[model samples]
Target: MNDTPGWASPGSAPSDGPDGKGQDSTGQNGDAQGAAPQDAVGQGPQWSKEQPPPAQWSAPSGSPGSSGSSGPGQTPPPPPPAPGQGWGGQAPGQGGWGQGPGGPGYGGWGAPPQGGGWGQGGWGGPPAAAKPGVIPLRPLGVGEILDGAVSTMRTYWRTVLGISLTVAVVTELLVVLLQGFFLNDSATTAALDDPDATPREVLNALGGLFIGTGVVLVVTLLGTIIATALLTTVTSRAVLGTSVTTGEAWRDARPQVLRLLGLTLLLPLIVAAVVFVGTVPGILVAVLGSSDGGIALAIIGGIAGFVVAIWLMIRFSLASPALMLEKQTIRKAMGRSSKLVRGSWWRVFGIQILATIITNIVSSIILIPFTFIAAAISGDGVGLLDSTGDSGWAFLIISGLGSVIGSTLTFPITAGVTVLLYIDQRIRREALDLELARAAGLQGYGTAPGATPGG
Candidate 1:
């Protein structure tokens, strides 16, 4: 049989009984060997010389079989069962669940098949797949992937949460400090709030805001890259039911961190370039004199570019885990991701978007209360929408605390989902479950003793 379950060789499968020719051969063989009278004569006196009365050999007169014609002293076969009735003797429609018309009813298992079926283990179904850790070693469904991620977090809270917390605290601390030092200026906040402010004032205020944002973005990006790298190791180990320490995860992930970072940075740049290329032509046309045409063309091009970018983004989403787990180069990792995601683009995209939406909603649920509390504590009274208001040190710290908490909780989820998705894709396309089973030291898996799993 193949490595996959549920497929069996024809000779190994269950059969109804001996074929018609085999039955004929058996009957002929028995006739040629002579009936009981010949054996009785040869055995002398051990067997009865005279047969019983003919009436005793025939079926009972009132029985269903008695009506059928048969030779003297030969029993007639019983009549066929009524419609809907099967081997279980229950009427066809009277059977409970799983009772097909003119077939066995629910829980009405008949005699075992000729080869071997009903008497074997597990109701004659295929063996259950092995489960080494948070997930079963087989192709996963969407719900199973999500549950595996959550299960990993729950099962290995120490490693997963430790990594997420450290990253979140450091990232949020930097954001708070940067904002306090650079973006808390009363002048900029006042100018931004003023409706009568000139374009120059607004631009200057916006410039400060953008700079602060850029710094935070860089810091956050670094934190995310680090967190994703470490968590990839943790999740992979979890798949094999192996526990890893934060230090061990770090060691495992450290070698490929640079490659992961490059991948993380490269994807966005690629997407941005696609978008930029699309809009540039329109911008040029607009500047060249045909403003309306240029605007229309640019919009169309931008839309098309955005669609392509999204496709590429989903296509390469699994690259990070591939790079981390497989120690693949950036280009090869991207290629691996593309190959795994081929023929499953929509499924991958849907899963990714669902995870993102869930994490974002959870983060928002956690962060919103902190935002209000920060506003209230800082004497701002819920000016969350009014970005012009300069947030005090108190507000920044409180909000940063919220950000830290939110990130700490959400980081594991996002990272786990991505890693699990990568594993799921590989299992579906490349039979990765076999390798995972072998790595997990499971018995009775793979092709043979010490045999390596195939792709």
Candidate 2:
């Protein structure tokens, strides 16, 4: 009789148990590998080879044990080799430890062969190596991604919040400076009316505007890059419970800034180019046609331009994150983002649109009053009381103040969501949760010997 915990009686065929392992009738080798032979009652043969052998045992062809047919009076043949070895006396399959066809170890039913176990194929077959920091694409609920985003924020709130505020302040300052000099009513009115103004005067004014705007723009751009890089670095480290200094974050960010900037500029440029092309025909028709025809053509062109712009934006929405986090080039990152986001454009679009609306609404609430107060205090209100006096300067100052306030309020939300969305998508597509869990020091993560994180 088999003495194993889950084995069956002697003379019975092997039966599959709940765990998918086989059981012998004699209740012998019920352990994962199988049981040993028992002594015979009458001593005709100490052990009958005809009885079903342990799970590992194999018998030669034409042998009673190999035939799997037992008779009441017949003596059984000797058992075969151990369970993992095949009848040919070879290991089930070949590959490095934990590197197999199904991935690493025995996988689910019908699952492709993994690495690191018997019966698994080699690397030349399917990919069996599990990698770190990569995840598989799967359907994810909105709440789940949101939860992850919130978790990320909690983990890296210091860096994310600080950088966001810094970027917001810098951006606000730039906007204020630009509005103060160029977007003022005095500048606009003067430019429009001074048709005979000296070219030098016009050039000087334009130069001031351009130089000021350019300087501010450069600062804003740098701030944005710094904010995004720091946020990504902090979030990733926090999720892993690892500490990273600002210097380390900058190091990681500096190398990818060019690619990120290229991607950023390219996406908008492509959209603008498409919109320009779409509108060109309409513009041409409007210039050379009757009023009604021109209006119709212009309307049609505008609609087409809007649709194409939306489509292009959706196609490349995830590129920024891919470029920054994966250290990929602009083209490759765009391609990777496009591939990963396949069939999920609408979801991403909805999230982005919602975030935009929310940020805008919040900013409006805070800035609207500030604008009114600034305009009232800046002498602009005097124009409303007395039409003879020009309040253009006052209007400029008021607008600048409002702009500064608005940008300051809105920057954090915008930057935070953008970075968070990128991380969320990666988690959904790459089984990033498991990788992150392992990184965060969770037990059982990468605990399996030879198991890689991203595989």
Candidate 3:
């Protein structure tokens, strides 16, 4: 062997006896070769330095000691990743992106989200049909109603506040004028205020009071009818995520104003009729035949009438919106409102009551301070309700300013809540969310030109 291999160095030999020197033409470790003698059953090299070491952070997978190998010298393929985790083979404590923290089985550290994407489920889906206008195109919660209403006012402050301020100023001005002219400080009025006044004097004073009251009622009613009709148009458009000018609102609402006025007048008349019908018998009994039975009947009838009137009001709460939005006639609007409110009486009632309370509470909070301020500014010489209250210009201006501010704030809140409630009821019962969403330009809401209001 030494004679035949004289041309080559021993270091480059393919096979060699254990040389103390670590030299090799083929890639094989000197330690591994020296430690074990190989038979002719295998290839030259079993392990290579070029191959990577097994990933430690990646948990090992195999039989007890087999390591998924066929024999003692064989290496196995890696196991598949566990479910609900990333496929990255990164080791633990590595904060690199695209890899699960703590290994392939955990989802921490911005691993690819495992949940299904948008439109797969109802929650956390795409905002295709979410709120796009003053309200969302779905069933609403109490907070959403309040929020939506406020949103409408904020969105269309120019139109909404303008309408409110105009109406309120006109109203307050009319009241002051009526008081100054028709309700002048008459000495005879003092006699009527006396408890022991004569019948004739009392009747005269009562007649004058009734006339002034009628004038005030008429002015307030006319103003409300106009304001509500115009505002309803604006609210309807607002729900569809559309803006409208006062002129446009008026143009759209002009046709409905008379009808709305009729409806408003009719409702109060109906309530009056109901109260009259319920209490007339009791009144007659008390007047014609004074008895405990008569008193009880009057009390019972009054309570029952009050309850019925409230029910009617709640039942018809949606009529104004229906009429303005749907262009429905008075009777149809009433029918539509009744239909919408059929199964949701208490909900509508509670929401209406709450909105009214919130509106009034906020208004009172604003107006009360102004009232006290006005009285103080007037040097305590004028009470707000006192007929002989001096024309302290500063006091009048401050009080009117307060009224304006309160009206401006309250008007939008009440109007928005009422409109949103109508929309909500329709969404619950008639799939109106789809219509609203489409109108608001949502993509998947069918024939979508737009989407519902959120602002």
Candidate 4:
């Protein structure tokens, strides 16, 4: 036997058992070879005798095993390692011999090998960026808002009805009592026309009428402010699904009364001032002009007045709600409301204008017939046909009754739209829907108050 390992001969068989290192003439290992050879230095048919064939290793063609005698278990020996390289450095899925980070060796196959950090094909990629101006409106419809108002009234009908009726009745009663005892219009014009009337006498009578009317107006103004503030408070609480007693609503709104009154007074005064200011130049131009110039000046004044009116209306539209709900000072509340409506001026204007028209039409339809009946029953309807007209009491009674009826019928729609508009703007600008949802007892999906969404 050759002193060299039995692997020297290309035709030598591998071992099958413990210590026998050589192949027999038939190219088969003796039963004494331990196991199949695995390491490259142990190659040869005798090496094979020490080790069973690799389970699935296949030999390349044109190698030493090209002979037909090689069994399927036999495979060609792997190529030698490269210089300065180790067994583990080979790239995956290449042949059994190549250079790699670890050194020359068989490499695994699949995805590229990753470094240890997150970005190196790992699980911690950068988060997605948020898109802008993509916030969605809550699922609210006009009918739903209207229904909420009706529901609120149903829930607190006593307070709303009582306050509203009290205002209407008191307003009408005072108007009647004033017209009856104080400024009788028919007698005033007769007194004004009297030839014997002195200037001082005339001035005294005029002052009395002015003071009486002013007192009535102040009473009406107070009633309006109190009623509106309370109504707004209840409406806001109701829409938010929160409970509000009449007393609580009234109490909460008490501190805001002066602010709201100032707002109410200031808004109209500002509008009137604008109209007065804008019309001054136009009126002067008209007074000093020919027909064409006068027409032009009048047209200019009208346009300016219209624009200022719309601006004032939009500016103060949310002021009352701001006062009642936010308890903001008059100037600050107006500023805040103006800020809230900055980008949505047109929408707010349109909704308010539409609501106003609808409320007016509905109120008119309900009250007009009553007004005619009151007029006819009080003789103003017949006095229009009679030349000796004494319809002062008749006119007062009819107008007072009409106003009371009209205000009662229109109160809910007006108050509802105002509160809804305030809430809508907050929803749009502040993401108030989530807060509302949470307030309504919804969970898992609703937003918390003052918590920024998707931050």
In model 2, which regions exceed 4 Å deviation?
1-140, 147-155, 181-222, 243-245, 287-291, 380-412, 446-455
Residue-pair clashes per prediction, in order, are: 1, 43, 13, 19
lDDT for 238 in candidate 4 is: 71
Best-to-worst lDDT order: 1, 3, 4, 2
Choose the strongest candidate by lDDT. 1
lDDT of 3 by residue, 17-92 (tens): 2552222223232223332323312433344435444432232333122233344543333323332222233233
User: For residues 102-194, what per-residue lDDT tens digits would candidate 4 score against the true structure?
Assistant: 111224221222332223333254322211111122534556556656676777677777667776788768767766666565555555678
Worst 10-residue lDDT window for candidate 4 reads 127-136
- Give per-model CA RMSD: 10.2, 12.8, 15.9, 18.9
Tens digits of per-residue lDDT, candidate 1, 254-313, equal 999999889989999999999989889999999999999999989999998999999999
Tens-place lDDT per residue, model 2, 1-455, is 43332222321321122543332333232221222222223432344435653444333323222123244323233333344542222255521122111111212122223333322332243323322222122234555444444555555556655666666666666665555445443553465358888887787668765776677676677666666666666655654556566678778788888877777778778887887787777778778876677677777887798798987787787777678778888999889878766777888888878877876887788778866765575654465432122344455455545655565545545554565566666665676656567555566654543333433
Task: Tell me the lDDT of model 1 at 382.
Answer: 43
lDDT of each: 0.75, 0.55, 0.67, 0.60
lDDT of residue 106 for candidate 2: 15
TM-score top scorer = 1
Q: Roughly what TM-score does model 1 have, to 2 decimal places?
A: 0.74
- Candidate 1 vs 2: which has more lDDT: 1
